[model samples]
Target: MAWLFSLSAECGTQTQAELFLAYFQKLSWTLQDGKTITTVPEVMEDNDGNWWCMVVPQGLSENSVKSDEDTPQMREIGNLLYASLWNAPDFRYALLGIEVDLFRTLSELLEDTTIGEQPSNFAGLVLAESIWDLINRPETFQIFKPGYVWIPYPD
Candidate 1:
């Protein structure tokens, strides 16, 4: 299956908001006490379509580096990606998207804070809300791509 991969890396003090917001919308949060929570954190998306936020959980486990190739920035990106993947709802919860973790790892790093600055290249971290937005618009996704998945649309 053809899949899209998104990754984020910091260029400086600015964080990637679009990447973060997309990840945010798809995440499901739970409390330490085992209670479920659905909190939509604050996001700033400009009129030109740039957005991001800081939603990293507190008291995360220590990060383990398996190779010398990992940089501090890369390590942090891995942490954000891990949090995104782990907290992501099952594919069933997605109306038009599927869970595709080409690979998985355990790592820790600080939350991204680089905003208002574009990176040279944004890989897997680029948001695909356009796809979701299209699908969500009154049977547009179904008409365009039939049988993509088995998720039932809200009637």
Candidate 2:
């Protein structure tokens, strides 16, 4: 279940990252149902070259503002936000488990796959299949857990 999300971005500029965060803060962000999803993004990195943030339905991560009933909505919202990165060639993301996060180019992610299309995270398919597909590669661990793997994506 997706209670919270650590969504980090590697945009061409800090403004892009800010715009990304700002996109969520707008009074809009509606879904197909004409309903809006709200996410309060807690930025972790802004001063640095990279941008990192934690997304919660309302409060910060430690507050655990999300509940079991909230998972479905969060999952859906997370899926939209996750896939939105594909809008730019430089944009990439890993829909990681609650404890981890990584950035990957859209091209890099589709590499060596039998199916050429980008795997949709429509409803958390990423949690099981995507994560497994990623971890299976011996080189992906270093980016997450220390001494693990790292599939370096082009900046």
Candidate 3:
């Protein structure tokens, strides 16, 4: 049997980090968090400044990390951030790189997003919705192939 591990995504900042440390007492997950992944990620940023957010910023554990790789807690915070940050029902999120500064506005994300035009380079915006769908239906992931773009959002 295959042993699959799902390392939860963390969100938030400093005080949140302190709170996670306090409550969990210790976090082997964060410590073991790798600087790499197994497969070629659908979304790869070539720019500099985009480190993933690990801080909640506000709320009781405002400065804490959303979870210590805990599934449920992290899911809630992740969803909340979706509504809190953008306030858009269909908003998609992506961890952008320093080069993201080129497009100051959110609408710019859709700029030149012709899926067929750049078959070699996948855009980060569409990758977000596609991944969320994959998270919900991982069975489809097994048949995933290189160069196959999955877009959950309708055209």
Candidate 4:
């Protein structure tokens, strides 16, 4: 099974997506193109006008697993990077909506902390908690809804 994590934000603007991509690039995560590992994630807009930020490991297809060694690590890293966007200074003023959700398929892998799992999840949770801490309004953002992957369709 292909291991994937998707972060969907209702910002509805390519500008916001670009900003998020910039922030994500600064973190220096390893992105993969075919068998090559890159430093930037591939970002694009879907037909429904939603921007998708995806992390797809090499050797894995849309619905098949080619390797399991890196699935957990990828999911955790994806989660961390997804949450860190909210910490950007421009984030609050970007006119981006606050509704975000994290979808993943490796629940079992999340239990392993070999690759700094606690810190990753904790950092993400801290950012998430800060959302509620700084704002006194009702909850408008959420990271719920699991097991959903956004696969890009080939043209």
Each model's lDDT comes to 0.30, 0.41, 0.28, 0.36
Top candidate by TM-score: 2
Give one digit per residue, the lDDT tens place, for model 3 in 19-120.
332432221121123321121111112233221222222221332333444443434433333223232112123322112222322233334444335433
lDDT of 3 at 83: 26
Q: TM-score ranking from best to worst? A: 2, 4, 1, 3
Clash count in backbone of candidate 1: 16
Tens digits of per-residue lDDT for model 2, 1-155: 33444454433345655665665454235665566656665444433345544344333234242456545554555556555543322322334334333344334444535222322321122222344355354322224232222232222
Residue pairs whose backbone atoms clash in candidate 4: 1-65
Q: How well is each residue in 1-155 modelled by candidate 4, as lDDT tens digits? A: 33343333322356866765665555543444333322343456655565544333233243223466656545544444444554642322111111223222122223334323223232232112333333332233334223211111112
How close to the true structure is residue 13 of candidate 2, measured as C-alpha lDDT? 49
Superposed model 2: Cα runs more than 4 Å off = 1-3, 27-36, 46-48, 59-70, 83-155
Which ranking of candidates, highest lDDT first?
2, 4, 1, 3
lDDT of 1 by residue, 1-155 (tens): 22222222121112444444455656544444453333242343333333324333222222222344333333444344444543442211111111222121111111222211322221233223342343332222222122222212233
- Compared with the true structure, the alpha-carbon lDDT of candidate 2 equals 0.41
TM-score of model number 1:
0.24
- As a TM-score, model 3 comes out at 0.23
- For candidate 4, what is the TM-score? 0.37
